[model samples]
Target: MISQEQNEFLTQVGPGTPLGLLLRRYWFPVAAASDLNNTYTKKVRLLGEDLVLYRDKSGHLGLVQERCPHRGVSMVHGIPEQDGLRCQYHGWCFNSSGQCTEQPNEPEHSTFKDRIKIAAYKVQEMGGLIFGYMGPEPAPLLPRFDGFVVDNAIRVIGQAVLPVNWLQIMENSMDPVHTEWLHGHYHEYITTQNGSKQEVAFQRKHLKIEFDRFQYGIVKRRLLHGQTEDSDDWKVGHPVVFPYMLAVGSGGLGTYAFQMRVPIDDHHTWHVWYNAYVPGPDVEIPDNLKEVCVYEVPYKDQNGAFITDYIDGQDIMCWITQGAVADRTNEKLGTTDKGIILFRQMLKEQIAKVAKGEEPINVFRDPAANQFIELPLERKKHHFSEGFASITQRFQTKYCPVAQDLIALFERVGVH
Candidate 1:
């Protein structure tokens, strides 16, 4: 456990905070591209700063402070003009660059517009998501991760605003052992898609966990029984993209899902789960799968209790039960928590780097170095047999929809 002071230093994200400043250096999705229209503006809160995101009539994107500079009016009720948003309270207007352009309440000849401005930042759209950079000047280019750049892929954005600290969700991603219980023996099987379900016990079996640092982030490897040292499971694992995002499945639909755990503040997180489905080389893409859908998911069931339907729901339960900014000061961690330990260490190191004014691991400067970044997925593709036991593999497969799709993808891709 860490001291209260140390905990605050790592998790608090108000302006000028250590962790918040570190996070600001990288670009994160502020909203779904398809959700933003000329009709309305989206309110975004990140790193404890409230901001507004909108698309103008001209189809340009704008991200600026949520409150107007003049009288601190909320832009949520503002009007989207041809180039910027105008305050509905008065005729005062601000451009997409957050520069005050018009002050109608003032004298017709007044020059007050030149003396005031609102905070604005660089915003860009890629892979069906709108991303914003809130760091220092000359912002780095948003790296085009391979999962977001698949050709002819059907992009899916899974958005959820969890009432918990972003750190809890992030730490959970690094922990591969949780699958043994939360998604394994402790979980009740629901249904199956493939042929006759195979039943096998997975309790008390010896498993090995490994962590390897990648160019972008960490790759977590879980080795189950019957897997050898040179096996793919023991080799490559899923990529935990720096900051917060996980690439899951995509072998079949020709897409992979990117799990984005974006911090809305110290206690709230904008959990945007991105899924991309790409059809095979010669296979015809289905018309139904072509439609784009972006929506928020709830964590409750019809019964009103915390939804325990599938693995994802179960995972959410873990996060919520931990409380917002979990009392890491009172928790007991075991050997299975090595990944979390490594994650915390890296967090500290990266925070220190940002403190020294040096860029962290995944922050890219050169545009050339920022595109088409792909990690080793050969393990996730070929090591499918190692993720669970045969007896409960179907339920495991059903729980991890991404991996299920990719398992078929691996077979088609002809990856040994």
Candidate 2:
């Protein structure tokens, strides 16, 4: 257990805080590219700061303070012009760099616009998502992970706003044994209660679990009841990519996905399930797949009860029940929680490194090395013997807009 001070040190993410400063060094997704299609502007909250994301007529992206400096009005209603965003209240225009450029009502000889500025950060778009960097100057390049840059692939984005801290959601990725209970036994019970005829496939007891500190973050391996050392699950397990993302899914001819846990603030988390379905070379990807499909995952019913039907929904139920910040001071951890303990230690070490004026893990710089960053994941999953139909019914993929079409795609490619 840790003290309250230690927990706060790791949890608090406001401006100038230790964790906040460290998080600012990396880029986080602020909005989906399609979110600004109709309105061309979005209000975003990250690390306890309110900001506005907009696209100008000249096809440039910008993230600036939500409030205008002239009259403190919201910039969400600002107009997107050829050069910058112009406030609707008074025609005050600010460029992408947060420099006020035009004040229509000001005197022709006035220099007030030159002296006015507001907070702004760099924004970039990749794979249908817009990411923002609020750190110091000389920002690092946005990482081009395999799922985002791969060719002949279909992608979809599913998001959920959880009323919990981002740290707990990340800690869930490290706990391997929870699958046996939370997603296995509890899953069986919930399905039975809901009057569903399907049986849970994750009932195997875990024999042993291990974690290793890799260059990216931590790679977790698990040995189940009937698995051996020769199994791919033990040889090349999946990884948690640095501070925020968990990379999961099967290898060769299967799906690859990333679970991005974006911190909205101290008490809220924007959880994104970014998935890519890459089939064999025998198949031809459809032309309509150029634009990614984005949807919101439902966690609660109309009656306000938690929805535990799918895998991600069940995980959300547990994370939200842990309270807003998860009181680690009164919690008890066991031997099976070795991975969680190791991850906490890693976080502290990285925090200390940043405190000493050094770069932490997963900050990319070299463009040559950043091209197509491939993560090593298990070629075979433990429950994959159940086949592709299992994935279509059990995961968030069930709600995908192209669910039936993808099933047909796998059939045509003979991947099942």
Candidate 3:
């Protein structure tokens, strides 16, 4: 168990905190591209800072402080101008760099606007998601992971804002043992209670689990019941990308995903499920597949109860029940908790590195090297043989807008 001080150091993500400083070194998704399709501006909170993310008339993206500098009016209702966001309250305009460019109510050619500025950060669009960097200047290039840049792939983005610390959600990614009990036995029990006749696929018992530190982040491998080390699950484990993402999915079936956890604050986390479905060589891609479909995955039902039927819902239930921020000091860890331990150690090491004013892992700078960085994954996942239909039912894909179209696409590609 860790000390209360250590837990606070790790869980706290407000600005100026050690862990927040470490987290700020990397980019995080503030809004999906589709979010701006309906409305140009979205009020977002990241690293405990209230912010407004907007798309100007010229199509440039900007993220600035949510409160207008002049009167503290929220920029969420700001007007999108050609070059910047104009506050609806006083006609004060700020550019993408947070520089006050215009104050229409002030004297013409006045230098008053020149000195006014608010917090603004650099934002970029990659794979239909808008990522913002909130750290120091000379920002690093966004690492183009394979799932985001793969050609001829259909993309879908699902998200949920959980009232739990980002660390718990990320720690869940490192814990392979949870899959056996949580998603396996617990899932079976839940389904049985719900009176569903569906078969639970993740019921397989794990024999062994291992963790390895890679250039980007941790690689977690698992040996399941009746499976040897030769299996792809053990041989080519998936990666948990440093700071934010867990890269997973079946490589053989051309289905890949990234579970990105963006810290909304010290008490809430924005969980993103980014899935890419690559059709077979001979399948004709549909025109609609060019755009990423975005949706919200519900973790709770209409009756104010946590929905634990699906895989993601179950995971969310556990994470949220751990309290707003888990009390790590009171926890008991075991041998099966090695992955969780390693992840904690990694976080501590990275936090120390940031404290020393050094760059942590996965901060890319070289453009050439950033182009299409591929992550290792198991070729044949447990659900590969079950086809795309069963796969959809197990995860958030069942809530996807184009779930039927996905099934049809896979069937045409002879995946079924």
Candidate 4:
């Protein structure tokens, strides 16, 4: 359990805070790659720092302090230059390294150019997203996913702006029981079968949870809440990477979703993600497959919304209702919250490590890692319909055979 002090520390994500320091240890997705095209400057907020994202004409991306050094004007009005971004207010140019290069208005003032520079962070592009590291210079190389670096697979990226704390959104990824209840039992927008509500339950024993640590090369066993005779106790183990990343799988769709919770502030977060799947060559990809969903959950509403609405709407309703701090003191967590407990414990441990200047888990870059897969077999029995069978058959026949060898290869390398 986190102490009151620790909880307070976790809530503050401003620069130098414990949670901010911990989160800065890993690279975070700040904007979509598509959004960075030929733009002079884009305003973004991450870890509570308001900053400007711009790409120089030389084709380099930068994350710099939002305010210009000269007049403290916001850099959002800057124009792209040959080698940097030039502030529209006075034509002060800054390079990708955040160094003020040209002060056209201050000719002969070499000292101004030499001494004036806005704060900047390391930025990189990977897997169709742009990532920024806001902590320190010489930051570690952005972590790579071996599974995603494949040659033949198509990639898709999407994002959502959720109205909740970053921790609440990140922790939600660790709770698997929500799938059974929120996605299954609840009469939400997504669960209605053509306007009809269906009561759904999970067969728990068959649910398997594994936490794959890329650095340690260990897949730990996770105890999940099993289905019982009297009540439905839903719990599943979820791997919580140190910092702010959570890797989770849905038991029904065999979909693995990676969520990066970027804090806009203490009360709002940018939920950026990449939802990818290995589609067979024979299958045509849908134009709208990479759709983005936004959810706005208020801070005072408890029985607010269901998970079935556009994913963003559902999350917003559920999380905002918990209020800004998510008063866990008044809440009761049981067996179904196992994943949540594990997540909180892991976070506390990582915070302690950060406090001591030690490296937390799963923050290193490893090129030899295996790909992760979310097995959908646990809920396969529940989906029994001609249409469902047809879809399954199409997926199996078109992709499974060709990918079996690739899947086996990943399995050999310890991906599950």
Candidate 5:
């Protein structure tokens, strides 16, 4: 167990806090690229700072401090012009770089407006998401993972705001033991109905889980009962990217997924799950595959019960109910909790690196290395299989509205 002070240092994310400083050093997804336009500006909050995001008439995107420097009015109501965003209040205008460009009412001789400015960060659009770099300048290039590199891959972006600290979500990515009971045995009991068969075969299986260091981050491996060293799961276990992303699952409908979590503040996390559907060699790609599908994955039902239909829904249910920020100080951790302990230690070490004026792990500056960086995955079994379509069908044994929406989509596009 940790002391209260340690817990505070780990959880608090406001300006000047240790964890906040570390978080600001990475690029965060604050809005969907399709949501911003010259006609509307999106309001977003990240790392406890409120900001206004918009696309100018000339097609340039900008993210700046929310409140106007002149009268402290929100910038969302501002008008998007070719040169800058004109504040709805008194026409105070600021450019994409956060420089004050104009004051309609100011005198010709006075340059007062030119001297004012608001906070602005660099923004880049990628894979249907607008990412903002809040770190020190000489901003790092966001690494291009396999999902972004594949040709004509369909990107379906689903977002959720979970009431919990970001670490809980990241730590969960490292824990594989929970999957045995949580998603298998325990899940069987909770989701069983109509005399449906339920079994603990997964839980009863002898399993060994291990963690190893990878170039980008940590890899968690799992081996079941009599499984050989050459088994796919044993070799290509999921890789958890440094700070806040987990590239999980392989083969079938899983086909590797990118789960990213961003700290909205101390008590909330902004989650964006990227599921890329890669087409098989024989499959013909559709024209509409290039377009992104955006949707919200709400956590609850009409009866106030957490939705447990999908694999992720069960994971999210546990994260939020653990209490916002989680009380680590009064908790007990065991041998199975080594992964969580390792994650915490890694965080503390990286936070110190930022304090020492050094670049932390996974912060890329070279464009050559950043362009189309492919993560090595054991996809032989996946691509060789008939296709991903049949795999997604097995999970839909139980009827769910959201699954129906997704399954129907699979039928239209021919899931790969």
Candidate 6:
């Protein structure tokens, strides 16, 4: 666990904090491609900095300070001109490089154009998302993945605003034990037909860690031995890179999901991602599988639902409950928090490295590569209550007595 001093240091991510400096070194997702309509300008808050995302008529995307240099007016109301965004307040146009290109109100004030400029960051587009580098000049290129661009794979982009701190939500992705209990052991699976339910068993892989310039932690787990007779186990591995990016999937043909936790502020985060790969002609995709959900709620509600549902709904609920600033001193973490510990340690180390002028690790700067795999057949049958109860009983006896204890605990806590 981090001491109060470390916590304070990590949480202070504004302009000059160590954590902020390190995070700025890498590129972060700002918005999806479709979010930029004909409007050309969008107001965004990321990494505690209020900024503007705009595309000039020349078609180049730009990330610049939100307010215009003149009169301190918001640039969101600006119009897209040749290669710049012109402020609606005074018609002061700034280029993608944040240079004042035109000052229509003052043709005689050439010094105003030369003297006024807003901060601009580097931005790039990949996989239908826009990413910006908020660091110093000569920022590194965006990293690429090996399996995100495969043929026939359907790519779905979605996002949510979480009320809790970015660290809390990001760390949650690293924990594997939660799946067996939160998603499988206690919860009822909502079936399409007759509202039937099935008991799920999560199959987990041994925790493994890979170290390059940055550390990559992997947790491979899956839903196994469930109700469907033809149900193939769903394997997923979360690859957590230093800072706050998570890549999930077994590198399988039909399974792919990635999430980037971008801090909107100390107490809020924007969870964004692309999920599900389109498969080859030989692969059969399931019609019932959901690809994405976008919603809003407080942050604390995240723990009550499974990972899938949490991403869809509960995360918002949880965040909103905290009322902006989460009291970390009251948190009680246990053995199941191994992954959280590992992640924090890695983060702490990287933060220290950045403080010392050393390069941090695992920043992906290139376009991700695509991988193709055959999709499994879809199972349409639903399992009844008796079958689900039998599986639950069997799972309790064979694998985890804690499963039974948890059911009782849920009842005692009035979770029903």
Ranking by lDDT: 3, 2, 5, 1, 6, 4
Off by over 4 Å in 2: none
* lDDT of each residue in 288-323, candidate 2, tens digit only: 665788988898999999888888889999899999
Which candidate, 1 or 4, would have the higher TM-score against the true structure? 1
Q: 3 or 5: which has the higher lDDT?
A: 3
Candidate 6 lDDT by residue in tens digits, 211-252: 223234444233333332232222222456557766654332
Put down candidate 1 lDDT per residue, 162-218, tens digits, no spaces.
889988898998887777666665553522233333232333243888898888889
Runs in model 6 with CA error above 4 Å? 1-3, 107-109, 189-196, 203-237, 281-325, 364-416
Question: Per-residue lDDT of 1-416 in model 5, one digit per residue for the tens?
Answer: 99989988888887888888888888888888778733569998888888998888888989999999888999999999997799998998899899998988989878897789899998888888889988788888877777756665666777888888888899898887887777667667765753554543344353677888777888877776666768666787668888888875454453556889988888889888776765454555555555676668777889989876556778888998889978888889988788888888988988999999888888888888987876646553321244444334333222322334444555655555
- Winning candidate number (lDDT): 3
For model 6 the TM-score comes to: 0.73
TM-score winner between candidates 3 and 6: 3
Instruction: List lDDT for all candidates, in order.
Output: 0.74, 0.88, 0.89, 0.59, 0.76, 0.60
Model 6 weakest 10-residue run by lDDT:
376-385
Clash totals for all candidate models: 8, 0, 0, 5, 0, 30
Q: List the candidate 1 regions with Cα displacement exceeding 4 Å.
A: 189-206, 250-253, 379-416
Provide the global lDDT of candidate 3 against the true structure.
Answer: 0.89
Selected candidate, larger TM-score, 2 vs 6:
2
lDDT value, residue 41 of candidate 5? 92
Per-model TM against the reference: 0.88, 0.97, 0.97, 0.74, 0.90, 0.73
